[model samples]
Every structure is written in structure tokens, then in C-alpha cells.
Target: MWQRGAVTDSAPLDVDLALLGGGGAASLVLAALDRHGVRGLRIAVVDPVRRRGQDRTWAFWGHPGSDLDPLLSASWQRVEVATPARRRVLELAPLRYAMLRSGPVYDRAAEAERRLGAIRIGAPAAAVHDDGDRVVVRTGGDGPTVRADWVLDSRPRPPARPGRTTWLQHFRGWWLESDRPVFDPDRAVLMDFRTPQPRRGVSFGYVLPVSDRYALVEYTEFGPELLTDAGYDAALTGYRDLLGLPGDGLRVREVENGVIPMTDAPFPARPTPRVVRLGTAGGATRPSTGFTFSAMYRQADQVARALAAGRAPVPAPAYPRRHRWMDAVALRALDRGSVGGPEFFDRLFDRNPPERVLRFLDGTTSPAEEVAVMNSTRLRPMIAATAGDAAHRVRDRLRPTRPAPAIPAAVVATPTPPPGTGNRST
Candidate 1:
């Protein structure tokens, strides 16, 4: 059983939880809390954009019958990894590669909130203050300030340095219908690093086929390169040419473009007392992988359990400081140019078992497994750099009396193994 109430000027709108952000992360947390039987908590989701629209796609590896199975809009049993040197066709054994489009997820979440009752929406928060005993959230409209015992902020952080090493992981996909069937709809082209490598960073082409005649082709990168309309035209031309496909045979449909952070700067976790951060703002996304939905869900579960037990939402069991450190190490490697982008991933996949790799990305691998994974990358340079960086970071932490060095402006921004490469068929 849960309790629900509205805040009045006299009562000051005190609720159990106040969530900022209406994106996937916030929704997942709300859903998890609801499922944990933490009911009647006056919840408010604040976001500037409330309408659901197609944004980006989320892909993750999961067991066949996982809890997230129902949320998947599409999935593939077979995935292909291609590099200039070699190609590997893997069957996702015991696990499947799943994708959930953003629109449906947002719609589902909105409906869920309505049914659950006491969950408010479309309230744009102006600012939040920690008053020690309670957190006060000031909003834009006439709505009264929301005071909560706990608050979860999931707002996307602004890039630490603007225009420095800016890269849009953007892509244009033609949901094409071919005159004649060309693609193996059952198989997904995970990475085609066969394209020309960018000198400043790394780039690759990917294709996700939904049917024999329909698929999405996209080009992605890790450094500053904004393609113009003409540039996209030329690149798509080159992609089709390289794939030995006739562009005239396919009919174009929809397109998508997205920019993701690729920096190593530490995202702030402590904002104010009784008000915690969630989603990417909370460092839920792996700085290297830009994957956070699963991590957010896991964190939500922990928070819900804590609330259900009548405990302070302080120690979320899912995200440990150690996991954040590992993400920082990987991001540092990229920022320092210590490893080539493609080769870094190639070595990772080649050395680690798919399951172990998945576990590491999910932030759940044990200490022994973590050691094994570190050795598998054969990233000696990265290993050495990480050790040195770790020592320096620790020393700085201990010597807080010393002035903290300013973090480089450009060094902030930015998981997962697809299952079944060990045994399943494509």
C-alpha cells in the first residue's frame, strides 16, 4: 500500500519523491518504484519536453526471457562484427540483442504514470534547494513548490567544453524497401569499420536490418565532424557503393541524428542534500559506451527497495564508486589518445568472453572477473596509464588541502556486450 497527497501552501507539497527529467532513466526509476510496492508517494517528473517523439534507439544484450523482453520492439538472433582485418559472425546463444525505440517507451511510461496515480507530469522545475530536512523544488508555473524527502535529478549535463573535440554520433537511416530482397533481415551488421578511418578520431558504419528489404545504414564517429546535407549525401553514396548495393533499388523512409558526450570529466553526483542524481547525470552511462538504460533501471530497483524498507535513499547498491572509477579509466584512455578507437574495441572483443564482457559493461563483474578482463584487452599502454592516473587521482583526493587543479575544459563527456557469440546461430 502507498500514500498519495497534493501539496498546499499550508502543507508545502511534501512528497516522498521528486524526479527531474522525463527521459528513459526517470521513467524506469518510476516504474521500478511502482513495482516495488512503494505506492502513494507523490511523484513529479519535470521536463521541458513532454511529448513523445522518435529520438534514438537503445540496444542491449539480454537473456531470452529477461524482464526487459516485453519492452523490445525488435530483436535479432544473429549479429556480425566486421573489421578491415577480419569478420566474425556470431550467434547470440542464450541471449538476444534487443532494441527499444524511444517513442514507444515514452508513451508507455506516460500511461503507466497515469494508472499509478499521484505521479505528476509536465512540471518544469526552475531550481532545487536542499533545506536539510526537506528538498524544495521550484517550478516555472503556478504549481506550488514541491518539497520532498528525496529527489532524483536526471537532467542531461551540459558539455564541459563547448566545441572542443565535438562529435555527433549522428546517422541517417533510410528505412528502405528494396525492389528485390537484398539484406538478411535476421542478421545485424554491428560494426563495419571497413570505411576510411578519420585521422582525428575513429569512424564506422553500421546497418540494422529489420526485414529482407528494409534496414538502417548509419555512419558514426568519436571526434569533431559535423556533416552537412551534402556531406551526408556523399557519405551515404560511398556507403552504398562500398556495400555493392544499388541506391535506386531502395526507397528511403525515416532518418535520425544524435550527439553523445565523449569526455572523461567527472559528472557531479552530489548536488544537494536529500536530492540525488539519476541517469547520465548520476554517471549511469558508461563514459566509453554511452549506454545507461540498464544501469538506470538497476539503480531504480535499488532505490525502490530502500524506500520500501523505510530507509533513506542514500546508498544505492547498484552503482558503486569502483564502477565509476573503471568508466573514468576508459574515458581517460580515449581523452589522452593512448589507444586507437577501433583497435581498442577489437582487442576487447577478441580477448574477453562475451558474457564476461557483458558483465563488465553492466558494472556487475566481480573482482576476479574484472582482473581477467583487464588482462584480456592486452592494453599494456592503457594499463600503465590507468595505474598512474589512479595513483594521481587518489593522491589528489587525500591532499584536499592543496588547491584542486582545474579540469581541462574539453575532457568531459561520454556499454555492453551483445550476447550469444559463444554458441548461438545467425
Candidate 2:
């Protein structure tokens, strides 16, 4: 049992737990706690802005009967993956690919905060200090100080350690409403590699059709750099032509764009004994594939279980150690030009069953299944990459600590959508 209190002028706002960021991570953690029937805990969620609009889109493949199914904007059991040479349309029987807007999630979180009597601090956390016993969080601009037994910090920060290879999964998507029915709402294109490839890294087109006349078309690239506004728009234009959509009748209702880090850096979850990290900061984003929503849920569930069992609230690893090692090798190969990105991914889906491959990507494959999936890829190059990456790690460990070279401004800039477009952060 815990006591709830309001902020006072003389002392800090004391609570059992403090969430530094009121984004998807904090919300999910709170939901997990509720699911486990954990009660009587005072919680405070601190963030500069509690955005509650349709600011982002989250897509994942899962079996039906999830509580979030009602909030899905679109879902499909059939998906298409294509290359210039061939295309495979897969039917996912037990698993369905789903897209969910952020608005419902934010709305549900707000309702939970009200019902749970949780405090909402609409201020940016300037700093979080774990003082051995209690974690103290200071907010920006003379905001209230929050002291709690545990702190879950989800605020974004640079990686604590440098990785051998890092790539940005950057993209711009446009929500289009057409004058005529053109899209097949039943099928979603996961990756269409018809777009011209960059000198380095891979580029692909993704399409999610919500209706016959409405869809979200995106141009995505996984590389060390981001594209300029004109560059992304130009690629989208070319992709639109390739899809044979009418030129003049398509209306861009909204635009979404963001960058997700795909790296093998060690993002330690427990920064301090009582301070835990969540979201991307806690390594929720998968390095090989920039998928995070499912991983975040898994992390949150672990944290809840720990607390319920009278243990410290610590989230588990988003992916197993062996999985991370495999992702590291894959990233290294992609960065070193040892594997052509399109050909590699094409071979993965073309040679293996879609269910096995998708499960492997989500880090749920058994050891034998994983071996089979690995066998489907070009084994020689991957084996060479494994050896090279291992040698590099050994060399790095023996060398003195050095700061990573600064990335170029053009390479790390947050992509901006074209003029006259509303933006959503993902």
C-alpha cells in the first residue's frame, strides 16, 4: 500500500515510482502494472508535452485477441514483399499485420492516469539523480521536484557505448485520399525494392491500404544518412508513378516522418540500482529491424512481474544476447559493403517460409528454426562477416577508449516533410 499526495511548496512531490517521459513506454508500463493488479502505488509522469493526437503510426504482426485490436486502423493477413526480379505474397494464418494510430493509446493513458489518481507533471525533466536510496528528478524551469523509490527514464539520449555499425531507419509517409478507388485494402506491401538504391544502404517502398481510396504510402531507407525534403518527395513521386496512382487526384492529407536508430550498442537497462530505463533508451528498438512496439510491451511486462513478485522493478532485455550478436554481425556486413541489402532481404523472404522468417525477425525463433533461417541466407558472406566483426570487437577491446567520430550534419538531421504538410513524429 502507498500514499498519494500533491505537490507542496516546502517539500518535493513524493511517490513510489516516477516516469520521466509520458510516451508509449511509460503508458505501457502503467498498463502492465494494472494488468497484474498492482495497486496502491503513487506514480508521477513527467514530460514537457503530453501529445495526444495522431502523431505517429505503429505497425506490428501479432495474433488476434489483443486488447488493442479495437484501436487498429487497418489489418491484413496477406502481405507482399517484392524485388525487381520477383515478388512473394504471403498469407499469415495465425498472425496478422496491424497498424494502430497513437491517438487511442494516448487517450487510454489519460483515462488510466485519472482513474489511478496518478500525478501528471507537464514539465520537462531537467535531470534525474539517483542518490543511492531514492531517485530525485528535477524538472526544467523551476518546476516541481519529484522523489520516488524507483524511476523509469525514457528520455532519449546518445548511446552509452559506441557500436561498430549504426544505421538510421529514416522514412517519410504520406496519407493519401484518392478521387477514385485504386488500392486493395486487403493486402499491404511490406517492402517493394523497385526504388533506385543508394550507393550504400537499402531503399524500399511501403504501402498500407486502409480502403479502396485511402492509403499510407511511404519511402523508407536504412542507411547512415537522411534525405532532404526534396529528395524524399522526389522518391515518393517516382514510387507513386511506379504504383500507377493517378497523378492529379491523389490528396496528401497528412505526413509522418522520423528516424529510428538501428545499432548494437549496449544500452544498459538499469543505469542505477533504483533507476530503470524504458523505450528506445532501454534498447527496445531491434537493431536488425527497426521494430519497437512489441519489444516495449515485453519489457514493460517484465518490469511489472518483477515488482509484483516483491523484487526491484527492472525490465528484461528486449532481445536475447545471441540475437543481438547476430544483428551486430548483420549490421556490420551491411555497413562494410559485404552484402547487398536488397539481395540479402529478398533471399530471406524468397527462400524461407514467411512465418518462420517473420518470427525470426521478432526474435521468437527456436534454435533449430533459427539455424534453418540462417541457412536460407547467403552463408559464405555472413560467415565472413561474423569473423570480421569478431576480430573488430577484439581489437576494440584492446585499444584505449576513444570518442566516436562526429556524424555529418546531413547524415543525422531529422528529415522535414515538404511545405504545406502536417507532420507526425514516429
Candidate 3:
């Protein structure tokens, strides 16, 4: 813990790197540095509240043998995507859909911090300034100030510029336990569009079954605004009924909720020579899917490689400019009433191979493959959207640079049943 002290301009601690927030990004950075064999560097991780429990969950599809394999709570070989008209179960042989909880990640980070002899400052960074050669970080309430040659800031901040179309990928999940064998542990439901759709955007149900009787069920939406507390509960209740889980011996074990902004805005990785952004602020989250775990890992690895090479530790761009442009067009189509979410995603998986679609989402597919994937969607509407997005870009370039408004924060509802419910049945 950082010690409280009298206010002073001089920093009490100096290190090679200072992580502004001790969240998943900070932990991943440390892991990446260790993996890249860059060690013995003084490091400090600063945050008012570090995650220590299963406060969140992350799901991504990746090839087997990842460094995070040991920490995975569950993995599914087959992923199911269902619409009202058709349901398909696609096998991800080379790649497995995996789930990770926050608790184990935090525990691993703690061990890494101890191994590196890094300082863990339990205080919020009030201000961070890049003073030419070094970065200065001032903690809240006169806590010890820190100076570092480089800083990876994971604190929540807005995008570098505004985007043309923005939507909130908000979700609320519940851990469920039932006496009846209600779930198939081998198969995970990626998107079950059987739920009620929103008037403007789209809503879907996501289920990850850890066992025959235990699963994490969620209600997700990609829309302009967030649902109210009662609204989400009602949706979840309807979804539970839709799944046909027995109501008598069912229990809500835990709850997790969050909102990720899905926008085409540019989140610059390095704002200054000595100061770089990490996590969502660094464009780790994909504008289309709100998936950040894989991208965060990629960003951390890039930064570690640069540091190991004795170069300016700037992370690579999260996605190619062409991918960003494509995402902007798709987002515009979704924002307008051009296509329904169910049809858009249904054709995405139904037409292309599951692996190709996943690769496209990860921005790894070739131009030829990408054209095929785009052609599967509503081409006419997408083409119109592309023209509009191109015009918007040209207008921005012609106009003088001005500060764009940050993405609006969506309304987040408190998780139901609170924490510590344990295995009690409802």
C-alpha cells in the first residue's frame, strides 16, 4: 500500500514503469513482459480498488495452448448460434471458446507482483503528466507520488475523437444452479436470438454451461440506450422461461453486469512519448463485438516486444485502418434501420465457415475472405452505409480539427440478488 505523506512536488518513488490502474490490462502487461524475458525492471501498479473476486467474466475464441489455459474456468468445443428460424451448432476444432473469471487472474497478478517486487499502491491517480523524459503520477489524498520512465494508463477515459455511430453493448449475467440437468456442458450458446428484441437495436441471450446443472446465463443488448433495472430483470426472467429450466430447484448463484461502448472512434495508443494508454482506452475493445481480452493480450505483447528491443514502448495499432473503416460502415448500417440484428448475425455464421467468421472478427482474414464475409450481409444497405461513412470521413478531414464529444455513458443497473448469494436456490 502507498503510504500517506505530506504534500510535496518531489516524487517519493521512481520506477521504470507505472501502471495507473491495477485491472486486467495491468496484469496482462506484467505477464507479457515476463513472457518476453524483460525482467528486473522496477514497476508500480496503482489503483484505488483492485479486483480480488469473480467480479467479471471474459469469453473469447482462440487456438488451444494459450498462456491463460491454466486459468480457464471452462471451454467448449462447439458453439451454438440460434435464431427464431434456424439453429446451428458449429464446431471450433482448431479454436476453442473459453471462459475466464476475474478471481484467478487477480490472484495470478498478485503472485507476479510479489515475484517482481513491484509496489502496489492502493490509491487513485489524481493526475498524470508527461514531463518530457519521465512521467509523473500524483495519487489521491497526498499519497506517495511516483515517477516512471514510461506509464501504461488503464484508467477509464473517453476516446481520442468522436465516431459516426455508437452503441452500448450492455449485459447482465447470472450464475444459475438447477437440480435438473438443464444445460449441456459441451456446448455454449454464443447468441440465442429467441429473446424479445428491442424497438431500436437488438437483444440476445448468452449461455455458458460449466456443468450439466450449472451455467452462466445472460441478457445482452446492442442499442443506443441501456435498459432500466426492472427492464433487464424482466428480460432475464423471460429468457429463463424460454430456456425451460425448472423453476422449483433453480438458484441464482451470482450476478455480473457491465457496459462496453461499441463505436468506431479512434483510441490512440500513445498520447505522449512517455505516456501510453492501455485497455479499452487503447482501442483494445473491438468496435463491432465488444471483445477485448484477445486484443488486450495482443497489445501487451506488442508493447513488451518494443520494450525488450530497447525501442520506444509504443503498442501496435489494435486493428488495421481498413478494418476500422469496415467496422464504421457496419456500425452505421446497424445504427440506421437498414438491417435487423438477427438477420445480420444469422447470415454471418450461416454463410461463412465458423472459423472464417471468427477470423474476420479478429481482423486476421485476407481481403478476399473479408469481401466474402461482407457479401453475406445485406449488401445493398451496407453499400449505402459505406458511402455515407466515406463522406463523413472526408468532411472531417476537410474541416478544421475540433474536440469531439466523448461517448455517452449508458445507464447501468445494479446486479440483482447482490453478491454472496453462494449456492442458495431461489
Candidate 4:
């Protein structure tokens, strides 16, 4: 193993793996690799925000006795889905909804890294390039260069087309506590469409009750809306009014907010030779669901196994070309105003078995299950978009024979607002 704090002025420190981005993907991969007895592999995690105290929660559906169950701090047995036309409560037998808070996850990962003594922290990688044989990662702030046999990049990708169209699904949630039991703590309100739908997209509210008196109430949108603090306050008020909950009497405990990109950009799975992409950067996230934590866990496990066996880390076969095509079709359908935003999902839940549909969303369903999902949707426009995207992809792949244009490193460092923001209705 390389000695800690040892760096030669002109030497690249050789390592097994270097992970970029310290979000859900990086943490999950590190944890899985540690579990598999992959020791003495020089691993370094690079992220601008290394210290974690962020208020974010990830929720996913898992069967009983899943490996993630032990890590969940809170969960729900029942989930509710609602639209203006209908409302349904799914019992979710054999499957439970689970949640993990970011703070605890960071603490656990940091402790594990310290115990293993195989990983390095606080090194924010600036650029990664594949130098024919190995992947070289340049770090910021005079940090030593790390040359790893394999590199996994988990950075979020900007939208493929500038000003094409984008929307941010962002929300702020207030943890409310009431003197008396005000919520059904055992159930999670998945989606309530009582809020007004935007002309260009859709909007809804979600509620997750953690206890008899405490709950997370969130307002979400799938279209453009960069909400100010006052806008979020108004949304909370509107949600309370629609739910018939006492707004004036409720006690506020804590608040959490986040924004997730909803796009159809094809994030490359393999960016360079010997370098693999993980997490959202690798299309692990379902475009329709914005759920990536569980997917990242599964992807990380596959990657760790491959590394242990001396194989290049390719994403699992479950995420085939068909899945990418489906996402592209759906995104185009939404973008072109071919389908009503809420109606599309409403029809999905109303027509298909909830479990099968959820499985498809999780990228765990079989081919037959995927067929069933396709049959449930209106097919003409979706199919057209799929064919068009396929043709475009093929043409682009065949025509790409030119050298990459020179791009200054400073150009990539500029922070811009994520896509989908411009199309949102005020």
C-alpha cells in the first residue's frame, strides 16, 4: 500500500481506483468495495463539497430482507398515489418504502473509510483523461496526481443541448410537529395532484410522515420553476390548504430542500479508455422517477465484482439500449406537448400492476414486464420519437471521426443553471 502523505514531485501515485464526486454514487461504491475484501486498493474520492451536513433524503422501494434494510432509519409500509380523477393506496406487500438521511450516510461512510485506511479524502479532482493505458486524474489545489487502472466518474452532466428545454424538480420541505397526532405515520403520500398543473409541465405535492406528529411536506414540479423562498412558502401554504390540514396551528421543526434534473441526455457510460461512468453520469437514474440511490448500489456492486475479477466495469445489461430509447421517447413526448403530463402517469398506474410498473422504473423488470409497460401507454407518438432518436444516434455514431476540439479547463468550471429552468411557468 502507498504510504499516507507521501508524494513525489514528479511521480504519479499508482492506484487501483479513483472515484470522482462524493455523492450517493461514490459513497455506495466505496461501501460495497470495502465489503468485498478489496483491500489495499488506493482509492481517492474527489468532491468540492466533501464535508456533508446536507439535508436530503432518498426513498426507494425494496423487498423485505434486502441488504439496504439495515441501513434505513425510517420506512413506510403503505404508499398513496393520487390524481384529480382517482386515488389509490398500494399495500406494497413484500416490498417496503425506505429512506436514508444524507447526514447519517456520510457519517457511516467516513467512519468506514477511516477503519479501512485504504481511501483518501479532501482531494477534489479537476479533470480526468485516459492516457492510453491508465486513467490520470488531475486534482485541484496542488494535490498530487493519481494514476489509477480504472476511474469511476459520478459527476452530474449538464443538458446535452443548450437552451433546448429543461425543468428542475425542486422542493423545500418543512418537518412539522403537531401537539396531537396529525398524520398517518405508517403511510407515505407519494403524489397528490391537487395542486395546479403547469401549462408546460406538471406539479404535485408529497408527504412523508416519520412519526405520529412529524412529517416532511414537499411541493414538487416537473417543469420550469425556479422558486424563491417566498414561492416555496406559498406552495407550502397551498398544500396545507388543499389537504385540509391546520396551517396556523402546526409547529415547524426543520426544513430541507433540493433540486433534481429531469432530462433525456444520454450520459455516456464509458467516457474514456479504462474509465467508467457511474451514478447519474452513467444513466443509472430513471428519467421519469429521479431515483438513483438503489440503482447506484446495484451498479456499484456489479462494478466492484468486475474489478475483483479483473474485468472492465461496464454497466449491467439490464440498462440496455431499449431502456435508453424508452426514456428518450418519453422525454420527447413531454417536450413536444404530445401527451398531457398528468394523464400519462395516471394512465400508467390505472392500467398496469403497480408492482410491475415500479419494477420497470427501477430497471429490475423482465422483457415481458417491459412489454406490458409499453402496451399500457399511448404508442404512436412515443414510437415515432423512439425511431427518430435511434436514427439520430446511429447517424451521429457513424459520423464521429473528427478529433475532439480543444476546450479550456476554465470553460468547464463555470457553473450554470441546470436545464428545464427556462420553460417553467411562473
Q: Give each model a TM-score.
A: 0.81, 0.93, 0.92, 0.85
**Please, what is the whole-model Cα lDDT of each candidate in the order they appear?**
0.65, 0.82, 0.82, 0.69
Q: Model 3 off-target regions past 4 Å?
A: 1-11, 398-426
**Superposed Cα deviation of residue 226, candidate 1 (Å):** 4.6
Q: Model 4 TM-score?
A: 0.85
**Model 4, span 40-155: residue lDDT tens:** 66676656666465445787887878656676767886888888887888777777788776666676567656655644645677778898698888887756688888888877
Tens digit per residue, CA lDDT, model 2, 1-426? 223323323247888989888778888777777768677888888887775767678888888898778889999999999899988899987889999877787777777776667877777888888888999898877568889999998877667667789898888888888999999999999999999999989999989999999998999999988899888888998999999899887888777777888887777788888888888888888889888888887888898898788788887788888899999989988888889888888888877888888888888888898888888888888999999989989998998866644321111112234645545343
lDDT winner between 1 and 4, please give it: 4
Model 1 local distance difference test score: 0.65
lDDT of 1 by residue, 121-203 (tens): 44578888898898888877655577888888877765322211223344444444688888887888777788777776677
Which run of 10 residues does model 1 get worst, by summed lDDT?
Answer: 408-417
Better of 3 and 4 by TM-score: 3
The TM-score ranking, best first, is 2, 3, 4, 1
- Expressed as tens digits, the lDDT of each residue in 1-426 for candidate 3 is 333211233358888988888788888887777778787787888787766767678888899998899999999989999999988999988989999887788787777776666777778899888978999898997467888999999777787777778888988877898888989999999999989899888899989999999999999999889888778778989999998888788888776677888998888888888998888888878888888888877888888898888877788888878888888888899889798889999999989999999988987789999989998998899999999998999998998776656664222222446444432211
Q: Which candidate is the best by lDDT?
A: 3
